[model samples]
Target: MANLYAGIEGGGTHSILVLLNQSGEIVYKGEGPGLNKWLIGLEECVSRIGKMIRRAIDGIHMKSGIPLKSVGLALAGSEHEKSKRELKELMMDKFDWIESVESCTDAQCALSMISKSGAGMLLISGTGSCCQIINPDGVSRQCGGWGNILGDEGSAYWISFKAIKTILNHEDGLETSLHDISYIKEAIHKYFEVEDNTGFMEIFYAKSDARKVAGFCVEVAKGATKVKDGLCLHLFCEAGRYLAKHITAQLSSIDEKILSAPEGLQIVCVGSVFKSWELLQKGFMQVLQEYKSKKNLKNISLLRLNQSVAVGAAFHGARSVDQILPLEYSKNATVFSQIEL
Candidate 1:
């Protein structure tokens, strides 16, 4: 029988599971509820993951008793060492058929998509935002990921929050810009399904829903890309600048040799916000250029992963058992931008 491995990428919004054969071919793929242990209890997260894996095995027509060689879980809220160890233990206890279990952060799994050497930087701007860098020697450094309240700058949630604040400020006569913000105002009201300020305040403050707020970024993107609204464009540009700050903050502690390498550093960008790179390019490039002058860096490559990061989690599972999956790293990523400083 072929050795079957499984991987799960658990996010704040949703979770993805993939089963891979020894040849690195994805045989079964599935998605289910969010697996953040903080949002849902740890046991519940593990139970959901187990059910997904069992369904995948059944979907592939595998026998009920067939054992999986390994399983990898890349989940949000599992970044800390304590969480990783606890998750691995629970998965082992629940699934006796699994021989090995590996647990890591979603960011780490995303980075593994491109950097086999484990030497690269990853910036995530989804419902939340964070940046992480791993050196060639295996040491890792991180800059952001402070959740919505403390940080999450440049995230979808941030953009949506900014949009609401801008409208409120305008209504309060705090904003001096005479440029018509009627479109954005209307978009905000329609997105939250609120007819007035009182309704908006109730939904936003009473429920305090992060996902609902983050979803508004889709409207913000439409406003910028489809409607060509200036205020919406400014929000994205500002988001780009904040994301650039994450990179610069990480780069500050990097070795000078790594910064001056001829091939340059690889920066893997992940999330929904990057879909509108056309709008973000201006403010993102502007900050990068300024940082380049200050640091005298050689160059940098910005890339996007073509495949779902669940594949990376599977690769991590294979590596944990001293096995290597034959995958084309180059084909898995595309260079969106390369800056020569």
Candidate 2:
């Protein structure tokens, strides 16, 4: 029987599972529902994960009873110590065929995607937004992981919400310094399938759906990129500035040397929002440039992972079991943008 490893990236919106052979080749892939314990109960989350794993194994015709060497899970809302321990124990108990189980936060798994030395920063701006930094000595600091109500800041939901609010303000005759908001207004109405503000309210406020709200960001991106709407363009640039703040908030805590190092600070930018880099670059670079100059930093590099973060979870699983994967971490990421002070 061949040694096999499993990695799962469990997010609030969706989850991905991958199976890798001993040589670091991915053999099977599967997807399941969101496994955030805060959004879905722990039992339901674990149950969905278990079913996904079983389906993957069946897909590969692995009925020979050869146990998986280890399973790595990077789950959202599993950052707490108690949640991590419970999830690990539950997975082990549910699958006697698994030899070991390691669970960690999804952000940590993302960090592993590029930083083999476990020293770097990860900025996430998906359905939610947050920044996490780990020093060379393994100390970790975080900023802006709050849910939508508190402070998603540069998230898709935030951008969408801002667009809607701007429309509402214009309708109420409160916003006077507006350029052309017709594109944003039309896009919002079409996206929500509503002709009026009342209809939009029912879907957004009455239903209390954050995911649906966040989905509108795609339309905003289209407004900026395809239609060239001024309002939409400004919204994206604003989101970029907010995201840059997530990085700057951690600067004081990180070692000054790391910030000024010749290699430059590597910041891993994750999430769908980053896909609109061209639209976001203006405000993003503006904020970063000002910060770098003031702090006297040498340079900063932003990168995006080339593969699914599940691969990193697999690497973590391999490491937890005292096994080394043949994969090269350097080739896993591509630099998106670099700014010099």
Worst 10 residues of 2 by lDDT: 104-113
Model 1 bad stretches (over 4 Å):
173-179
lDDT of each: 0.85, 0.84
Q: Model 1, 235: alpha-carbon shift in Å?
A: 0.3
Going through the candidates in the order shown, the clash numbers are: 0, 0
Q: Candidate 2, residues 189-228: lDDT per residue as tens digits?
A: 8888997988976876678777789999999999899879
RMSD of 1: 1.9
Work out the TM-score per prediction.
0.93, 0.92
